[model samples]
Target: MPAPVLLPPTSYDYVTVHKVQGTTITAASDILAAEEPLEIRLGFGPTGQREHRTLAITMRTPGHDFELAAGFLLTEGIISRRQELHGILYCPDVEKVEERENVVRAELASTVPVALPRLERHFYTSSSCGVCGKTSIEAVQAAACPVLPTDGPYVAAELLHQLPERLRAQQELFEQTGGLHAAALFSPEGELLLLREDVGRHNALDKVIGAALLQEWLPLHQHVLLVSGRVSFELVQKAAVAGIAVLAAVGAPSSLAVQAAHNFGLTVCGFLRQGRYNVYSHPWRIVGAATAGL
Candidate 1:
């Protein structure tokens, strides 16, 4: 069989590091979450008339890069469905072997137009709150996908309490380096579906979403998304675009994150630990939550 195209060589799995104590010195190795810059390119239009363009370069931990690129496109409102993509390939150029694994090219349908200018502005754009350029409530609405209702999929309070442990158990990289962030997808019954880790929290979210897109599992209304860190408006926006109903974070939620969750009708749960956690917005989906605590 031919070489598997998507499975590029991993750069670093573990590295050697030194440890020190007050009066003793020991040598040991540490697992590092490898950080690298990945360039995402888009190939649009049909055969013989395709236009290829550079999209963005993001710093991310290696692995699941193709998924990261795909998920990034989908959550950014670039491509909606799996069919919109024709293929994803490592840069086929023989001359650039050094970056052959670092670069990924997304082959989009000819009918699709690459929204580089808008995406460029959005990718580089930073906002104190809300999504890229989604400054006001109206602007957020205009830029986002249609809000998925927060009804149905009643997640038990007990299940919410266990999500952090479940998500952390599957974090292979975090257990090693204690440096990377993870985004995990779980079913309503609290089963782990997928977990992605990266140095960048947003990249981890993108990686998980990309995995879902590849599996044709968009519109995750019946599922829950858990991130390793605090909730941000961008994370909320990504989950909203993917139609995820419940978003849980081990850390707290930013003010705009709660606002975005509230505006989009998503259930935002934060500070999730053994017993105590806070519900920031749309508590309806968390069943029996009010009976337990405020």
Candidate 2:
């Protein structure tokens, strides 16, 4: 007989609760998505003269902290390439043992420049929203994320319909907790490639992008990114920064999110469930559709 395998401590927590369904009351153990504050610090400047700074603190589910940090930096325009990051590790000197895993330090190569003033404007981020403290839409545009290529990687409308089901199947943590959001990457052929889950929608996407970055699979120009929630301006910005051409969500897209997707030349698909979906921008990427009305 094999011993029961346990999930990572930071991924989820179990609580004994009373369940009242209709009229009956039953005590049961419920799993909850774990959310914790992660402080991201940066080490940049020339080799011996390197400087350290606290970049941003975010509340996120703790499983893939390194990927989350790398993705956050890439999407935030802090570091463009994986080579720019020398290494990512947990902070060694912490006041408490528990705090050690909550802090991550990303050391940047000497060639990479650190803009303290620019990075300081948006220092604190919450799990609910990534762009809460952003100054303006103009500031996001100023990040200079390149527009996606217009050529192929077209996906069928039928394939889009099947994505939600495939994504749901692979959501291991979500199945247990039902409280975490997910971000999944699929090939143009609709094959599920990678998936990440987190308490924050943006954090989930960041983890996916971060894992892709660390694996040297970036500039994901030919893939589709699907999120288990509504599309937001921040998600659009992050997708565009990662060079992902297609961004789909299970829910609706905010007006600003659609506008941003249009500006970035990234295709936006929303209301992605059942047998149909709405194409918010760059409809040409989705094949097998009737566009005669347009």
Error of 2 at 250 (Å): 0.6
Q: Using lDDT as the measure, which candidate wins?
A: 2
Worst lDDT 10-window in candidate 1: 1-10
Error of 1 at 147 (Å): 3.0
lDDT of 2 by residue, 79-182 (tens): 88889989999999889999999999999999998788856754755434555334535566677476588896699888999899988887878889999899
TM-score of 2: 0.93
Clashing pairs in 1: 45-110
RMSD of 2: 3.4
Q: At residue 51, give the lDDT of candidate 1.
A: 80
With candidate 2 superimposed using the best TM-score fit, by how many Å does residue 263's alpha carbon deviate from the native? Answer: 0.7
Number of the predicted model whose TM-score against the real structure is largest: 2
- Stretches off by above 4 angstroms in model 2 are 1-7, 126-138, 291-294
Off by over 4 Å in 1: 1-13, 122-140, 290-294
